[model samples]
Target: MFHSVCQVPTAKVCGDGKPSRRGRSFIYRLKDEDQVPQQVCKLFFLSTLGYHPTNDSLVLSVMGKDISTPLAPPKDQRGRHAPANKLDQKPLHEHIESFHPSVSHYRREHAPWRRYLPSDISMKLMYADYIEKDNKCSYESYRKAVKSLNISFTQLGEEQCESCLLQEQHVKADHQGEAAVNCPQCEKWQIHKDSATGSRLHYQSDAERDLPEDTSTRSVDLQKVIMLSRMPGVKSAVFTRRIVAYHETFVSVGKKTNKKNTISVVWHEGIAGRSAAEITSAYAAALEKERDIKHIVYWVDNCSSQNKNWCLFSSLVSIVNSQTISTEDITLKFFHPGHTFMSADSFHHGVEQEMKSRPGGVVFGCSRIV
Candidate 1:
C-alpha cells in the first residue's frame, strides 16, 4: 500500500529560547511591500550573561525605546514638605546574616578587674602570641599562663591600683602632707564624725574585707564624690553630708585649702547645721571679696535642710548675685552610688587607709562618709 509522506521539522526552531517564544510562527504584517521573505527566524533577548539560550543562534529583531529612565514623582501641593530626618523610622527586615570566627583567639576580659594597676605586659603578650587559630592546645596554654600570672581573670597589671602604697605616698607628698578623708567604709577607725561638741569620733572596720574570704581578698577602699551646682558662667561647690555635722566637716575641709586671707565668720563649735541666716551672711561676705577663685564647684549631698531651710538657699542666691554670678550659671549634681571608694582623690582614699592604723575607731563613728 502507498502512504502519504510528511517531512519532520529541524531542532533549531523549537522556540524554548530567549523571552519564551514557545513555538510561535509569525505572519508577515498586511503583506505590506509584498517582497517579504516567506520564512522568518525569531529574535529573543536574554538578560543574564554566561548562560545559553535553548537555541544558540536566535535571530535579532529591532525592539522599542529606552527602559532605564524613571518617571517623575506625582505632585502633592497640598501635602507638607518632607519630614525632618529625625522623624524617619528604620526599615524592618525578616532575617539577619552573621559570621562567627572558627577560633576564638580574642577572649573577653573584665575591664578594671584589678583597678587598672601598672604591671608587666609580658604575660599578656606571651599569651597573645602563643594562641593559635582553632587549636585546643594553644587555648590550654593560654589558660595555664593566665593561672600562673594570677592576672588571667583580673585585667589589672598590678601597676594602676589607686590604693597602692606608691599612690598614697604620692598623694600625701603632693598635698604637702595634708591627707584626704578616706571613705568611712574603707578607712576604718580613721573615719571621724564630730559629736555635738565638734569632736572627732572615729569608726572602724577593715575596708579590705570582701566576699569569698577563703579564695580571694577584697581590699578595703573609699571614694569621695564631689558635687557642684553652677549657673551660666559661674560655679560653686556644695559639700554633701548626711547629718548636721557635715557642715562642720565642710568648713574644716575648706580650711585645708590655701588661704591667703582669713575668713570673716567664726566657727561655731556649739551650733552647726542651723542658723540659715548666718550661713547666708557668710556666703555674702565671700562673694563681696575679690579673691583669685574663679569658678567654684561646691559638692553637696542630698539634704532636706537644703530645701527646708529657706535661709540657706536664700544666702546662696544672694551670694551668686553679689559675686557677679547669674542665677542660672550654677548647676548642682550628685555622684553615682557605691563608687566613692574608687575615687582617686586624697581624702577619700586616705581616710580608708588611716583607719587601718587606728584601733577601736569604729566603735563610735559611722562607716559611710569618705
Candidate 2:
C-alpha cells in the first residue's frame, strides 16, 4: 500500500558511479488504492496521529524535529518585550495618590469611609493637570489608576455650593486678573464655604455630644425618587415610564447611650405624593415612636416644600404641645445650603446598593424595593 501511494523515483548515477541523493524524491499519488483523494487521506492520517491538518506551523515544527528528541515546553512571551515608552508604575501611582489630599470623606456615620472628589474634577481634568507637571503616562492609564483607588467624583445626589460654582465660572470668564481679585462673588463664596464648614462641625458636635437622659439628636433627609420596575442593562426599560417610590429616612443618635436608630418610611406615588403634608406626616410618625425623649434636636436640609415649610412647623408645634407625648422642646436645625450631608443619606445609599445587587438586576414592582 505504501509503494502504491508513494514511490521514490530512481536517482541518476553521477560520474563516480554513485546515485544522486537529491534526485531520489518521494512522488505522492493523488488517488490511493481505494481511489480516495490524497488530501482526505492526509487529513484522516493526521487525525489518527492526534494532529490537526490545518495547523501547518505546528505540524511542520514537529516534522522538522528529530524523532529521538522530546518536544520542549512552550515559552510565555508576555511582558518579555515591553515597549520603551511604558510608564513607570511608581510615579504614576504617586501622581494619583497626590489627589487624595483634596478628596473629602462622607460625613455620614455609616459611610464615613467613602471618599469623593469635587464634582468639577474629572479624570480628564486630572490627566491634564498630571501632564502639566511633566508626568509620563497616557490619559487612559491615568484614568485606570484613579479608578483602581475606589474614589468617586461626587456622592449620589450631592449638591454643589451655588456661590462657589458661580465664583469659579466668573474667574474663568474674566480675561484680566483685576476683576476676579475684587469680585463680590468671590467674597460671598468664601463666606458660604465658612458657614458650610461651621454648620458641618456643629452637626458633628451635636451628634457626638453627651447629653441628659431625655435629650437626643437626629438627622432627616428625603431620598431621591426611585423608579420601580428597574431592569438594569435592559434596553427596553430606558423609554418606559416606571412607578416612582419615595423613601424618607431618619437617623437618630442617643446622647447618653450613643446608640443609633434608623427609620425608613417608603411609599409609592399611588399611595401619597411627596408634598409637605406627606413629609410632615411621615416625620411626625417617626417622632411619635420617640415620645419618651423630652428634648429632640432635629437636623435637616433647607428644602422649602418639605422640612422648612409651615406645614411641618405646625406639625412639630402640635407635637410639642401634645398632652400624651413627653416631647416639650423641639429644636429644628437646618444644614447650610448645598452641604447637607446627613446620616440619613447613608441609608439611601444602602438601599440603592441593595437594589443593584438583586438577582438579574431587576426589580419587578415597588413592593420588591421595600
Which one is best on TM-score? 2
Model 2 alpha-carbon drift over 4 Å, by segment: 1-144, 148-154, 172-183, 231-241, 253-257, 359-370
- Candidates in order, TM-scores: namely 0.22, 0.58
lDDT of 2 by residue, 1-370 (tens): 2332332445588789987765433333345689775633555555555668554354435333343344465578888988988777787778767776332434433445556776677888788888998777877888777777666675555565676567667777873433344667777777887898899889878877787778778788888898877777787886788889888777764354765466667788999999999999888877777788888888998899988898999888888898868988999899888788776666677777777778344332222122
**Model 1, residue 38: C-alpha shift (Å):** 99
How many residue pairs clash (N, CA or C atoms closer than 3 angstroms) in each of the candidate models, in the order given?
47, 0
Worst 10 residues of 1 by lDDT: 92-101
Worst 10 residues of 2 by lDDT: 361-370
- Put down candidate 1 lDDT per residue, 174-245, tens digits, no spaces: 655545566342343122211201211111111122222111111111122211221223323224322222
Show where candidate 1 strays beyond 4 Å.
1-269, 273-290, 306-310, 323-329, 336-349, 352-370
In angstroms, how far off is 41's CA in candidate 1?
99
Tell me the TM-score of model 2.
Answer: 0.58
